[model samples]
Target: MVKFLLLALAFGLVHAYAELEGTWYTTAIAADNVDTIEEEGPLRLYVRELTCSKGCNKLGVTFYVNANGQCSKTTVTGYMQEDGKYRTQFEGDDRFKPVHATPDNIVFISQNVDRAGRTTNLIFVVGKGQPLTPEQYEKLEEFAKEQNIPTENIRNVLATDTCPE
Candidate 1:
């Protein structure tokens, strides 16, 4: 009877913890060099996907939080659209797995190595929320027009996502 009770308790605890799965909207906030990056593009739109059984284990595409308080990414890929004029591919390796993830916030660290062997470590704390609404999208269109960034480019950026609802 004690063993059965213990098993039930374990199952309940596991169920209470939320796993990082499903599609999530992401925006890249420049930790440093914000002026240059923001002048080019103020925000980025991307997606994060996680696959885990009881919780995320191996082969998860999104971030994971280990027993310790460290956030890491299993796989990270996205695109950046700047000034509504240009779209560039952004891809990198996620170094820190997620230590804690929730609908309101996500924390992770990523280490990226460029072709030149230069390494960049990016720590991301993102807010989980819905993408821009139609009105906001239209506003961005106007902003892109004034900024000389093609509206089409902005539209493309806003359309990118992790999965279809």
Candidate 2:
């Protein structure tokens, strides 16, 4: 009986150590204009929640990954702010299939089907902890610039209102 209990506990621990098991906010960087040298600001994202039905039956909200590679929920919902505003609402299917999951990061590709059933590709990346680095920030800025998004209004948007958490 003790051996069985220990085995079960071990299994549980192993299952608990999987990465990319929390809420992460990501932004896409696009180019603004050809002549401009600086990239645009990073877009903020709120993952809200993640649910897996087919392969993994787990729901994660605000979970943080430890240095030892264990994920634990600090709260029911994780709150994060990206550098810039979101161009559109974060809406889509309730369940997202995992293309990749690790202790530190998760990447999932999903399709957002509207009421009319028009589908759009949605790519999500959730980091376990910490924010984007300076280099990453630069990359995002460049991407925004490429997209031709005006930088003049980004500061206004970020300063005036609070995005949904």
- Measured by lDDT, the strongest candidate is 1
TM-score of each: 0.41, 0.38
1-165 per-residue lDDT for model 1 (tens digits) = 999999998776455334445555453322222222222232232446544442322324453322223333344332212321111123332233443365654544344444445454333434355455566456545544553444544323223333332
Error of 2 at 103 (Å): 2.7
The TM-score, computed over Cα atoms with residue i paired to residue i, of candidate 1 is 0.41
Scored by Cα lDDT, where does model 1 land? 0.40
Maximum-TM-score candidate: 1
Alpha-carbon deviation at 77 in model 1, angstroms: 10
Please list the C-alpha lDDT of all candidates, in the order they appear: 0.40, 0.36
Backbone clash numbers for all candidates listed? 10, 21
Q: How accurate locally is residue 35 in candidate 1, as Cα lDDT from 0 to 100?
A: 26
RMSD to the true structure for each prediction, in A, is: 14.1, 13.1
